[model samples]
Target: MKNLILSTAALALTAGIAMADTVRMGTEGAYPPYNFINDAGEIDGFEREVGDELCKRANLECEWVKNDWDSIIPNLVSGNYDTIIAGMSITDERDEVIDFTQNYFPPAASAYVGASADVDVTTGVVAAQTATIQAGHVAESGATLVEFATPEETIAAVRNGEADAVFADKDFLVPIVEESAGELVFVGDDVPLGGGIGLGIRESDGELRGKFDEAITSMKADGSLNELIIKWFGEGVPTYNADGSVVTN
Candidate 1:
């Protein structure tokens, strides 16, 4: 009986070690600067860099898994991956479904990009990526909300006149507007939506969430998190100073 109990405990220990050895990092590899696939077809971007550092700090072997934004959370809940390192915003609605680590990115503005600056964003058709806070806002803003499967499609809707404007994170829209060469311009006021972005994990996986939270706290304390935020989102973006106070524009 004693031998059997000792062997059982050993097996559990081994299993726990195996689980800690490889943590799957799930992300939507389409949101550029936050996360996206490179020409080599490997996940690359700000979240990837931050995730890698976090994994290193936590001493966990990590792998990246790309999933569609529309079903990212459902997949996580269904055990598709260990944790979601995507640029997902933390919100009360989402918190009820899954646990979140402390936010790595600060809350930022959402803006509208349209073909014409005079477009009435409140009444005209506006496009947003499905399952996002921007989409929810558009749906409730007295505008005709057009939901798309991907961010690219939202921008295409505006260009093709399927929608008058596309609402999305201002950082994501900046590059698109610049590349349009005056064809697309920012319209209407910037709307602040959602809390800061965080890593989502299964509610049952409290240990994993705590590990990441510790890693993130270390990054914040050392100012590496702020550096990465500025490196990816550019200067003047809000970030925590060394003293843990938020430095904003």
Candidate 2:
């Protein structure tokens, strides 16, 4: 079933691997190719590997618990889990609540609209080092903006005129646009909004944090991370290149 460990991932517990080190993990088993439950009910994705590596580096055991994305943080805060491996974006706002390891993956957020639309959205300030997609509709002059808590809600709101356009990740928006009843299109000329994702845990779990960072270093150094990105995102995601160079702008 593709269990994460071939052997206990080299336990890295501070005073030696903790005997009670069954680290509880939180994930939003919905984002496919990141951390989702397949039709066979097995949880798999890039973040899944991150969890596995962390356990090995920390010399701990893992117990992954799939939860709704919205509820993930609350559960962790309330002591329901030990770490969060969801493709959660690391922002100052989130940092206020939890600590993060160095980012294992950096994801780009984009807007999407219907396939029938002819809007050119790539006209925002261009950076010599980045690409960007746009939100399909322009905000009404001086119109108030409302941010949705989840990507799905944002897309639905745009379709209903409850909002003008949605800003979301490509992974979530692309599939939604294909089935949207309204014109589901994103702009192309907007500024690239990127804040990528990282591992999360309670602020007190410093032991786990060190382990996670170490594992990230190992995976990146060995090229496992780049291999996984290519396998999932079709070479679009910036992993690493054949010459050990960062394939990002």
Segments in model 2 whose C-alpha atoms lie over 4 Å from true places: 1-19, 114-150, 153-164, 175-183, 241-246
Q: Which residue segments of model 1 deviate by more than 4 Å?
A: 1-19
Model 1 clash pairs? none
lDDT of 1 by residue, 80-142 (tens): 788888778888777777779988887788899999999999999999987787887888899
Per-model TM against the reference: 0.91, 0.70
Error of 1 at 69 (Å): 0.9
lDDT of each: 0.83, 0.58
Error of 1 at 217 (Å): 0.9
Pairing residues by index, what is the TM-score of model 1?
0.91
TM-score of 2: 0.70
Any idea how many clashes model 1 has? 0
lDDT of 2: 0.58
Give all candidate RMSDs, comma-separated.
9.4, 9.5
